[model samples]
Target: MEIERSDRPPSRVNWLLRRVMRYFAAPRLNMREDYEKVRRVQRQLAVLPGPRFHALDVEIISADGDHPIPVRVFHPREQRRDEVLLFYHGGGWVTGDIESYTPACATMADLTGCVVASVDYRLAPEHPYPAGLEDCLRVARLLLADPTRAGIEATGEIVLVGDSAGGNLAAVVSQQLRDEGVAGAKRQILLYPVTHWDHDPATSEFASVRNHGDDYRLTNTEVQDYFDLYVPDAAQRKLPTVAPLMATDLTHQPDTLLITAELDLLCDEGEAYGAALERAGNRVRVHRVNGALHGFITLPRFSRSLREAYDVINEFLDERVPGKDAEDAT
Candidate 1:
């Protein structure tokens, strides 16, 4: 039953992936050519074998904001369900968009039987700090206020889901909704999320950073680079709006499913956040999938680990959430 090494060594697929990633590694990050390398990488990956899940791409002008926020809605066959998920695509707060994450979103929609609305939030460096988060929060609030206007049924509930940098956005959004007394967000699913920013070079602590930091695709330094670009102000890093891990009050935050890859650099922070949420008395479940690497959710076609991750999420949803797979209104 236990094939993966608990010590978190690189799997055969990831070993090959490391080679491919290094091959496509970019020159450096700057404003002008920042997305080029990732673009190349995504192009290469697009050709790779992966699940083909299609969805209806819709454009909506936010009621609170003027930007044309593009959202991809994954509708199950026959009819649509009332529940919805606001998914944020992960690209280190810099490179990801809804298109890159469409396949995964559509798959999740099918699995969960809830319409998945993956938001095309503005990326960082070009947009920076609060810009992308603002887009997500606006989407949550606007959708909750008038779901029908956006073509989403009024389910009177929302689940926030994201991975990596997008997971950070999901956490902060949940915190804000809780703080503002917005009652719609009932659960949050954060996959290998970035929860804290203790940027002290001297501190090579934390079980994950000291252990699995090197072999993983998301290195500690790269994580720091993303944090720096997202929040240039060091003091602002302490703000709950930016980092939910630093939030003083974790009280009554949404019921959570925090999934962390055992080999990920962010594993400790994600687990710690789950602990803090438990301390705050919120129902939380955290899982560290064995031998999995970061961004596994986007690699369904390549990894069986992705299926395991889905199994955990589906178990959580069907067990905890009401209207689990309730028949679509014909």
Candidate 2:
């Protein structure tokens, strides 16, 4: 499948921004304090607040029956759909939280006309690997069991949505639900998901890692650093739970709308996962945003790439039956 490309040249603003980020925001995996700095930076980046809306924060028990997990529910001004979007924010499993992702969640609810529930799962270097994954799974199961638990009045479908590392969680949770023979999300939207374990250009199978790894907003060094914190055991990184692309069986998963940014290091692997899903006899649609970087979904509402992504996402949500055959849109 051929990915769509923009005829327009890369934005000068983006180029300049990347240069600035390359120097100032470069990952320093030395101390635990460095992670806090990353989180602070993420919070500061969310300057564009969303339109006023009703929001509530709720605490739900974790899957382990031990701790409580925080979830934020956002209600759009006008409701157009009965579905609830279970969102997981991306911060490489370390930085992002409900507060940092509030603007994006609010905008998502308003744009899609679906109540958005953002999961504030446990982060890494403190709660590594399966801890965060467990929190996410517990929330997904609770919502699927009863939508009203999260104040979702509408008893419609529960769609799993996530970007970057959170996208990885959504995919894994969907698969785990299916494996457990429980009700799973009928639809999932993965935005530039981390589907593979390796990001090193020399070792990675995807060309995007080699082509765009160093120059974009998300660098290979930073991603590796995140992985180091999230999963210190390198051998375990290949597990299906960590890297969905490494899964031996991709069958019977949720209907998927996998979107990737053309310049993202994860682009090819995300698209490859979509292809694997299609080959495994699942319904899938893959769209690539040209000239965009990873994490574009959280950009300001006025961002062109952000607008283009939501358009595709909305179209996917509006489909009554997305069809059985996989589609690669240009």
Window of ten residues with lowest summed lDDT in model 2: 321-330
Clashing pairs in 1: none
RMSD of each: 5.2, 4.0
Candidate 1 Cα misplacement greater than 4 A, ranges: 1-33, 47-54, 62-64, 77-82, 154-156, 199-201, 321-330
Task: Write candidate 1's Cα lDDT for 1-330 as tens digits.
Answer: 111223444445457776665443322344234565775666566555655565777777755656788888777543334567789888788777776676677677776767888999887777889888988888888876776655776554677899998899999998888788886577889998888876333584467876655455666656666777788887898787777888899997878889888767787788888888999988788878887878889876346778778778877776644453362222
Q: Ten-residue segment with the worst summed lDDT in candidate 1?
A: 1-10
**Model 2 misplaced stretches (Cα beyond 4 Å):** 2-21, 24-33, 44-50, 322-330
lDDT of 2 by residue, 1-330 (tens): 545444466445466776775664344343345888778877887654446778999899876678989899999889998889999999899889998999889889888888999999999989999889999999999999997777677678899999999999999999899889997888999999999999999999989899777776787888888899999999999999999998989898988999998878899999999999999988788988887888898877799888888888898898876443343231
Global CA lDDT computed for model 1: 0.74
Instruction: Give lDDT: candidate 1, residue 194.
Output: 82
